[model samples]
Structures are given as structure tokens and as C-alpha cells.
Target: LIKITYPGLLLEEILSTIAGNCLLCVTKLDFSAPKSLE
Candidate 1:
């Protein structure tokens, strides 16, 4: 059971990291975009 579960947990961690990075990038873009447009 431990072996089977380990890969799923690792995959979740990787996915969460990627999602967090994407959110950070999007937030940065949202913050900067209007200033550039104006």
C-alpha cells in the first residue's frame, strides 16, 4: 500500500507546486497590466 500511495502523493506535490507558480505569475501579470495600459 505504501508503494502504491507514494507516487500519488508525489504527483500531487508536483502539481500543487506548478499550480502555485502559475497563480503567482498570473497575479503578477494582473497587477502590472493595467499600469502598462494606462
Candidate 2:
């Protein structure tokens, strides 16, 4: 049904956004860390 599909699609979108933000944060941290320490 349209109603069920709508919520599922919204959930997927939210999850994708969260995942993208997490990845970006990790990438920034990776670049900021010292090579000798890592």
C-alpha cells in the first residue's frame, strides 16, 4: 500500500543521511589524526 511504502521510504532516507554524516565524521577524524599515532 501507499501508506506503508511511504514510511519505509522515509526511514530509508533518514538512515542514509545518518550513515553519510557518520562517514564524513570518520573521514575528518582520519585526516586530522597524526600518522605516527595511528
For every candidate structure, what is the RMSD over all alpha carbons to the true structure, in angstroms? Answer: 2.9, 4.0
TM-score of 1: 0.78
Specify the highest-lDDT model's number.
Answer: 1
Positional deviation of 5 in candidate 1, in angstroms?
A: 6.1
Candidate 1 runs further than 4 Å off:
1-5
> Ten consecutive residues with minimal summed lDDT in candidate 1?
1-10
TM-score of model number 2:
0.73
Per-residue lDDT for 1-38 in model 2, tens only? 76476998888888999999999999988888876476
Q: What lDDT score goes with residue 29 in model 1? A: 100
**Residue range 1-38, candidate 1, lDDT tens digits:** 86476988878888999999999999999989999999
TM-score, per-candidate, Cα-based: 0.78, 0.73
